[model samples]
Target: MEVQLEQNEKKGKAFIDKDGKTLAEMTFSMAGTKQLIIDHTEVSDELRGMGAGRQLLQKIVDMAREESLKIIPLCPYAKSVFDKDDSIQDVLRQ
Candidate 1:
């Protein structure tokens, strides 16, 4: 299994496997000056528990960090993922 992260403009997505076989994905819109609102996060059931979600989130986080963007996880999955994670909390709204 392979995962890939791709982004365009102010939108970002994490795609797993080629041929559009997405295992987990996240969508977000930029809000200028290192700030963004995460709209959604989805992980295929079959891919769940395999760390795919974390991989996807990591990719998104890396992108955000590289672009110096803060994040507001509006999606439940995203929020929950971060709730227990301290590593990515620096990018979250305080």
Candidate 2:
């Protein structure tokens, strides 16, 4: 599977798939100047148990680190992942 990222100044998405079908996606919007609010995440049934959701979130986290931004995980899935991963705290909104 491949993950593709698309973003501008105000919003962004991480999408993953195989063979032209979407497997999962995570979306977020900018909050103020230095933060991002992760608002939604979805994994297709066909991709369940494949860690695609985690991959999407990781892509978002990687982008945040690269851009020197923090993340507020408003999406439950993202929140849970952030809560469990202490290593990502560097870019997590308090």
Candidate 3:
């Protein structure tokens, strides 16, 4: 299976798909020069507990690192995911 993710700026959406079917979607807004406020993350009911959230989050983190930005997770789910992820602590806003 091949998964693809892309930013849809018009809709303020991040789409995650596997073989053309969307598995998850995340919506976010820019908070500032280096901060992003993730509004929500929703995974397909059938895809829940399948690690798709982790994959989407890792992609978000990678994008933030590449752009030299700090993340301010406003969504509870996002906050929870990063709370125990020490690897990304360095890029989190203090």
Number of the top candidate by TM-score? 2
In candidate 1 the C-alpha lDDT for residue 5 amounts to 68
Candidate 3, which segments miss by more than 4 Å at Cα? Answer: 1-3, 8-12, 18-21
lDDT tens string, model 3, 10-47?
22556677666877976767676677767789899878
Better of 2 and 3 by lDDT: 2
Residue 39 accuracy (lDDT) in model 1: 88
Off by over 4 Å in 2: none
- TM agreement with the true structure for every prediction: 0.83, 0.93, 0.81
lDDT of 1 by residue, 1-94 (tens): 5657666677767767646566677777777767878888778888888887777778778877887778888988889989999989978877
Model 1 lDDT, residue 55, Cα = 78
- Candidate 1 backbone clash number: 1
TM-score, prediction 3: 0.81
Query: Cα lDDT of all candidates, in order?
Result: 0.78, 0.91, 0.73
Each prediction's total of clashing residue pairs, residues at least 3 apart in sequence or on different chains, is 1, 0, 0
Candidate 2 per-residue lDDT, tens place, 37-64, comes to 9999999998889888888988888988
Q: Total backbone clashes of model 2?
A: 0
